[model samples]
Target: MLDRPTFTISNVRSGDVVSYPLVLFDGQLHGASAATSVTVSRIGADHPRLRAHTYTAPSQAWPVALDTGVFKALAFLVPGENVIEFRAGAEPVAAIHRLVVHYLNAPWDYCVRAVYVVPADDPVGGFQAPPHERCDIDSAVHRLALAMRLLQSALAELMHRHGLGRYTFCLEEPAQARACPSEGGYEEVLVAYGVPVHVHRFKHSRAALQALSGDELYGRVGQALSGAPDRESRIDVALMSFTRKDAHTGMLYGHTALGGGRLALFGSGSMFSWPENLEQVPRRFTDRTAVDGRRFLDDSAGRGEYWALASTSMGAVLHELGHCLSLPHPHNGGGIMARGFDYLYRLFGVAEPQPGAEMQAPDEPRLDRSAATRLRFHSYLIRAGSEPHPATLYPPHPPPAPDGAVSVPVPSPSPTPTPPRPRLYVATNGLPARARAHHEAHSAPRRPSITWQSEGVVRVSAPNGLGHIGYYLNGDVAAHEEFFQASAPVHLLDIPWREVCRQCGNPPAGAKIRISCVDHAGQIEEAFERQVGDRP
Candidate 1:
């Protein structure tokens, strides 16, 4: 294919010939090879009747020109975002290539790599619910299809925003080609209404889908998209289905872009397994679970990448799409992509683009315009033959924690038992760091206690009703299952060291040490320094 393939379209202004390179993908190549025959027809949303065109393979086999008749017929097809389904006759699998068909636009192409279908069950797909007596497989399939379409559309939008102008969808025409139960499977039913079908052994699996590493998925999709033999003969988007909810050991995973940059759809078992109308699978993690101590990351591990956490809604999918397109949370974006459901909803009532709206680069890894454009393409593909009202926009949310009074705790000294030491020393005054003081307030509770051994190994008892206790001198907070102190007058050494110290070096005559203790709330008490041995 030429770096630019010129296609002339009429029914518009001058210079209708626009050239955007077609992504020659393997699926298209395979589709063309197997297609007994193909016919290109212009069925515009606003245009008149349908017109047919011819596309033939070349003799020299270098680069083939679309038939002149086909070119003329294509010329009549009006521009500005169109869905062109490449019709297949008796082909085992049907394919539809949806090209945005822009007139004289810049070079553009979009690609959707792997897709997700999060279920209403375990988001991770580990636990299986007790099988219900009545199962609604059709409903499950519908949800699966809905999720797939959302993923496809979001990815296409990402690609389109990145400047890709073409989109496609491929699915195996079921052999029986039976009509899906009245309500669900409308798209598939209409497309493959009377066509023969092709069957695949396995469809989608949540746990196994992430088997493909990020690099593998990226490289393979890029390669297939850049180099396929048949440029315009086959469908662009490739539809893959999964029978099981796709998952791995972790929350994240990726898959390869098969058949040349064609998008992959992973319809998991949950699609055919979960009850319809279910949203937000409730999950709780204990301290021992993997989710415990786990922190969600702000960035993806690579360039041209994004991340998502699934909720059983289109909004959640949109949020993920934002990530996939390299768009940050709208809260951070100000308003460009923010929504109430996202983390930023509790604050201001208006949705505003983040502080640096014009700036594109994020310190963390993200998708570029190229990826976003591709996502737009997927979005177009998913919304094909249908219209969904645009999502409602919301405002920025405030932080979860509030700014308020700092809470503090009182301390109690515990007893200590120890052997007598030859040396007895006393230090007077001290001041604690702000961090240490704050930490004590939160860590210690109302009934706090401290334990430490005396230098003489003497036993010291502590006040029974003391509220909190603090460790002396050390900046680190201390907690133990059992107390070590026997008792305490709260002074170091049994000697009248204060008078002795005053007599000796006159050691400033009145210095004091501060300590931290626990309180009733299991938090630490604040530190207080005192003066010793004045005239009193």
Candidate 2:
């Protein structure tokens, strides 16, 4: 019997622009007594063999030999789309694999302008400086300086993570006394009703923003920064530090007018302030310490109220900026664009829960495959000469699914088709009593359930033959299992909970576990389970 030849490619992905010294290894030369031949060909109108390499075993044993090869230069790839194929040996017995390469043009430069806003009556008093910089006189100046410093540092961190190292932002000198004008008669009605008001606050509304032209908003950013219109590509963000709450909660946080020349309004109160009590912060936000032990400029030891506040602010800005860049909040629980701020705080390692806290640790933040693909698509659009509108870059969110439903599967046409739904279960001894109580209280029939045990283990059983099974924890692919036989038994997979958690960044209160399975004929099904319990 002839063994099948196998090989592996290293350090390059499909469509990636590769550099020199391509590493290829783990070649098994099958059914060869002597040296085996391999040819590299560029597939096109005229298929040309780029080069030939030989595989020889250190000491030949029997029917197979192991070897490695390297390609020094990839001069064969042309400007646009190119296909590279590797064939081992000749004719029908040869093992062949192909890779497609898209040699891309230079990436586009996306720019963002961060404008700091202060109250008109007290232009400098909204921000607070460091202890050493604090002065009894000119407190406003100190406040403005502190606010500017915090925002700058936060923006820097934000850019490094989401910008893919290509986006840049400029911090303009603080925009002072630039209050949004209120409607003449509306202010009188609010005053008659005894509604509290702040004179320097901008009216955070779409209609209010639409009433002013781009030039009027640009003017508020100060004369030195008024040239942004000349740089039509820039995303203008006004960071307002306000003491009074807006009538609407959404307005208090901030608002963006994507149609209004890529402009966004962000309130510092929600973004920069941390709750006085550590317990008040979500468990996920304060569960993990920073991996690098890096602290912010204002944070001395790197894990406390100051660090939490700074890190949270950075995450909030990143989230709002993501919207500014035309990206929407993802359905998954990971990444800056997700529903909660806890993941962001955990991603930066700025906070962790005090010992013996009841709350589950925050799920760590990650740029999953979907988010990366969306970003890449946006980049491609920018590179293809599409006018960049930082606000409307991505498509809007699809309508929500039925309550408690994760996802619905597309219809299938196969006879003897596999079930369209898959079931998942978890057994963990590490779940806290309170968490268990919460889970049991909210448990529903047919819904995914968590069971208590002495050890943590996840068991996945499929009635239909399992062709491919993938395990995802907290939105990242953790592990996968495959069955190649055409007629395999009902597949049962048992995975250690510790192993799954380890692959998912060790979220303390357990991680969100998602399992996707494909049947023998390629019918796909998915199930989601949130593993809530004490850390094992």
Number of clashing pairs per prediction, in order: 122, 9
Count clashing residue pairs in model 1: 122
lDDT of 1 by residue, 38-78 (tens): 33433443333222211111100111112221211111223
lDDT on C-alpha atoms for all candidate structures = 0.26, 0.37
How well does candidate 1 match the true structure in TM-score terms? 0.23
How many angstroms is residue 331 displaced in model 1 relative to the true structure, after the best TM-score fit? 22
- Give residue 296's lDDT in candidate 1 (0 to 100): 21
**1-536 in candidate 2: lDDT tens per residue?**
56655444442334433111111211333443333444555565242322211111111111122232322112134334556665665555566666765432222223344444443344232533233323221232223233333333333233324423211233321121122333221111011001111123333433343344445544443332334332434455554443232334322222222213355544343332332221222332443433221212222123445445445554555555555544444444565566343334443232234444413645444444334323322211121111122122221322323432222122221212333333111111112222422332124332222232346676655443444555566655555554432344445666676665665556656557665555432234455455746454
C-alpha TM-scores of all predictions: 0.23, 0.31
The C-alpha stretches of model 1 lying farther than 4 A from their native spots are 1-136, 148-200, 203-260, 263-308, 311-367, 372-536
Model 2 residue pairs with clashes: 124-140, 125-140, 127-143, 284-361, 284-362, 286-351, 286-352, 286-353, 429-453
